[model samples]
Target chain A: MEIRKKRRICLVVAYDGTNYQGWQIQQNGNTIEAELNRALSALTKEPIEVSGASRTDSGVHARCNYAVFDTAVRMPGDKFSYALNQRLPEDIRVRKSYEVSPDWHPRKCSSKKTYEYRIFNDEFPDPLCRLYTHFTYTKLDTDRMNTAAGYLIGEHDFKSFCSIHTQTETTVRTITDLSVKKEGSLITIRVTGTGFLYNMVRIIAGTLIEVGNGKYPPEHIKEILQHCDRSCAGPTAPARGLTLVEYEFL
Target chain B: MEIRKKRRICLVVAYDGTNYQGWQIQQNGNTIEAELNRALSALTKEPIEVSGASRTDSGVHARCNYAVFDTAVRMPGDKFSYALNQRLPEDIRVRKSYEVSPDWHPRKCSSKKTYEYRIFNDEFPDPLCRLYTHFTYTKLDTDRMNTAAGYLIGEHDFKSFCSIHTQTETTVRTITDLSVKKEGSLITIRVTGTGFLYNMVRIIAGTLIEVGNGKYPPEHIKEILQHCDRSCAGPTAPARGLTLVEYEFL
Candidate 1:
């Protein structure tokens, strides 16, 4: 007799993280992961628990977020995306789905994630895009931002750049690429990394904005990294301005 | 003895009509206009009212919707937009503001309005854009859709093209321009008119889709218009695909 492999489901999710606490199994208040659990349970008529790749903080966004869950349903993995999307809210979407091994975990997967931070470098605020973008009146030198970003391209001890409450065994991670570009009033900072600590991207963005605004020189980034102290870094940028754009698996 | 001047506040409003009934003040349920009234009353400390250029139906989108409200407040017209956006939801925004003459009404001003309908003509529905786009799998003929759209241009009696429940005094309207373009799996229908009746744009889109799907020839649109019978027209398209792009004040 031929044995059929057990089905493990993988979900690619997109969400407006404005309202939720974060993408985690929160015990208090609302969270994107909790909502997905509710939606998936309703769709599959079973208790569907999921583990997300990143526990993105409140007010953050994800264009191609990932999650993995195990289920014994007879539906094909690809068909689960359509079923889940039909039950999800307008702000959250299950973009893709696939089958995986029962041991597969979104958080444990070997992957490189790309995040983009948007800053509206304008004098007046845009009413339509206030939620998704950060507005600053001071002129930002994109060249300066780019120059500062280049200093942190290699693997480094990012303890000084992460949040104080971050619970991680390793503070070392590889930042493969970073670039800044301006279009109209929008300044987009794209960063690619093997892994990021809690509030790591936001702190980097905040420090870069400081560099762009002349508060800190591009060379100051080198000192901050060498010190490995959180106080040496700039303030954390607001969560709304940061978005997880994409992720590539190895 | 001095004459009191009337203050006409021009508003550029944007909305995601997924939850609300539409841009008009409907008695059935919630609406963008009604929400605006509530927000305006809280801002001005007066029961403010507004008239929209187009009473878009439920689930329609607006990039720069037009509205005019007459108020006696001492607040500057430009500042009203800024203040209102602070109190509005993330999806709705006031893009701009201006003061116009008392006679310059958003609904009555002689100009043109542009509406775009997006059709996701694909085999599978898009998970990322479930709410913002309409999905169809009939394999539309762009040549036929474009040819049928051309017949809609110029002044004509659009009685059969509009919803039967439209209670407008004029069934005759001037459609200044109509164009259809296909990009990959997306088909965009751009329509500009002096004014539109209830469900006019959606009905036109449905009629064009019929022609593109080979249910009717491109020439059938002209015949449908001449019939002046509601039954001769095609089905009404869903409101999700329609977007009020902008209005040009000539």
Candidate 2:
């Protein structure tokens, strides 16, 4: 009897996420993973299920998300991106694909993730930029936001910055960098971390925005982190403004 | 009988232009003018007709498209922007509105117009930027493009760059400035002129792109302009990349 060896393939995906429920499969709505699975199943002539590195929430965009699946198909790994893209919607694209060790698991690997939250600080909303950015009529002070973001770096308990619905065993994470930059009427909050709990990035963005708007001082971030309570933080920023921009596995 | 003098209201309008036919009143399709007329009629309680300064082609965007309409409504001129925005679609917005002299006409006045054509030169198309920018996989030489563009500055007969279907009797126009700038994978062609013939900016962009791609030499623009024939220039670029960025009356 001949045994066919299945190879593990990792794909780097990019999606608009405007019309998708999320990166994960859900019963009620369409998702990036569901479309990917359907396309993979059709291409490989096998029922394929992929494991996503991050299960981003609905309306959250990603420039580079990671996913892996095992397949017995004879097609070249790099060719998967082209083949899958032909069947996928325009909003979702497979940026690249490569072969990985069969034993490699996405969640088990140590990785660095980067997210960017965009804010359009203008008197009126820009119709062209409304989809990807959060609109705020009030002016924002980037210097204050950057000062507030300084306290978030390094290892700390991020429970206050995480959604209460998260089921993570531990809430401690190491933030490598956090920056607030303003250009014209656009403000961007970029954060890089070892790992994040559910809604961590959005919550942090909301807190920083409050600091920028003078509702909270720059020092308030310390108090919020020390409280270790979700209620101590500001409201969660909208998902539309946040984008997963990078995923680097070590 | 009390004579209610009709006042001319000039609007500075902005629109995404992705869904509209153009800035003119079209019989078979929706347009920016049609929407403005509808909103004005509802707001003023009287029939309103507007004349547009530029009848932009389908898929072209505008940051400031000028339009003038006469109405008997007593509402403050600046308040029209707020009132019309409430009734208009999300894709279109009235940036500002003010009362103009009854004799003032948008097209008759001497004005300088600025148009920008954006090209996303990358390995693959970015879905998020698809609506506002034209995507090209070929590498573009900005130096060559800028050199070609330089020949277009100053007054000249733009017959070679004008569309054959234009109804204008004269193709002579004065170009104040023409520049090609590149940032990362994005290339922008910005042109400011006293007046433009139909499809003039788009044709110039296409011709400059050809020069950037090595299809034509930098010195070819001088010969093309001297030819005084439409066929001497490159094809007209797509309307999606063109935007009316500014309109300033002298």
Candidate 3:
């Protein structure tokens, strides 16, 4: 008998993480990855272990995310999205799916990731968007927040911006872009980078918020980066408003 | 002894209707209106009975909904939004609250109401958006759908579009505007009217969908309207994706 060839597939997924622990495999009941695997296994009639490009934290949202899985089922690879989405939960969907080389690893591929943080600056919370955004008070200086974010766009030792408990050996990462804009009572902070340290985006948001509120000078970010001391960074913002927008393979 | 006058309050509320039985006060386990009343009553230390502009069906969303109530509480009406929102569930919120004319009736006021219907026109369902949108197959013709919607505009006896179980005494209503557009795989249908018959928007969408799929000609809508028979209309579309975008008071 001939050996079965493994077919690799790429996926674009969107999720509301309020109910999930995170994307990784865990002993607990709910996980985006576990749900995906279960859905895929049911669809493909086999055990399909998938690997996600980023292990996004719980309470995060994603408009588009990438994941890869290998399956030896009889179905064509192009039809995988339709098949998998049918079995998945409504809040997490496979936007699209495609065939890729078996060696294409979702994590190892060279690319950039984009994340967005939303702040509801209004005095009252928007109940409809409560689960999808963060609410905050205390006036923020847009100019100062913008100025502080400028210091983050480039290669740097991001140790100060990451959680002290980050498991990665090196906290060095290249930030490609950062921006802050306000629309009505909503302030949006967007960041794109080659990679990120643990809790980096949320920490950056919190630090920038301090600059906006005049609690910290815009130039303070440079010092925080130079010191590489976790204590120098601002507190971690809440996780509700963080969204993993996308990952691009280039 | 002098009697303190009662204050009439108006509120702009928003909610995620996934778990509740819609906006009305129901004898069932929970309702958005009941929850808001509970929170408001608890905060003001008074019995409160709030009336909503629309009794939205279960699973329907509202971005800006109006409600009015009479109370002799001591709290300032402007701050009612802040106070009510603090105690409301994470899924329901009061965006703004202010004192209104004692005669102001949320449902009686003649205003343009805007409603939007969303359909996921993809081959597969999105797990993340499952609870928030409706999924349908068969390619849709947006231009044709828009053309058909034109027949719904203007004053008419809309008895055929109203559900048989509607409690309203009159089925005559005016549909000021109707439009349909497709953004990628998402088809959004927006309707503006002085008022809608019971289940009217969903029925209109369902009937238009038939036209989009070529099962019925655009002109067929005119015939259905003329017949004045609910059976002549298409099936009522799902309630999940419909949203009360706003109400204009002039």
DockQ of each candidate relative to the true complex: 0.23, 0.58, 0.58
Runs of candidate 1 with Cα error greater than 4 angstroms are A1-5, A30-32, A35-48, A72-74, A86-92, A102-108, A120-144, A184-186, A211-220, B1-6, B38-47, B87-91, B120-131, B135-144, B181-187, B211-219
When 1 and 3 are scored with DockQ, the better candidate is: 3
User: What lDDT would each prediction earn against the true structure?
Assistant: 0.86, 0.92, 0.87
Model 1 docking grade: acceptable
Q: Write the per-residue lDDT of candidate 2 for residues B165-199, one digit (tens) a residue.
A: 88887889999999999998899999999999999
User: What value does the lDDT take at residue A234 in candidate 2?
Assistant: 93
Strongest candidate by TM-score: 2
List, residue by residue over A155-211, the lDDT tens digit for candidate 3.
999999989887897889999999999998789999999999999999999999889
lDDT of 3 by residue, B84-117 (tens): 7778778887878999999989777778999999
Candidate 3: list runs displaced more than 4 Å: A1-3, A139-143, B1-4, B123-129
Model 3 clashing residue pairs (backbone): A89-B127, A90-B127, A90-B128, A91-B127, A91-B128, A92-B127, A92-B128, A93-B127, A141-A212
Lowest summed lDDT window (length 10), candidate 2 chain B: B122-131
Clashing pairs in 2: none
User: Top model by lDDT, which number?
Assistant: 2
- DockQ computed for model 3 against the true two-chain complex using alpha carbons: 0.58
Q: How good is model 1 by TM-score?
A: 0.83
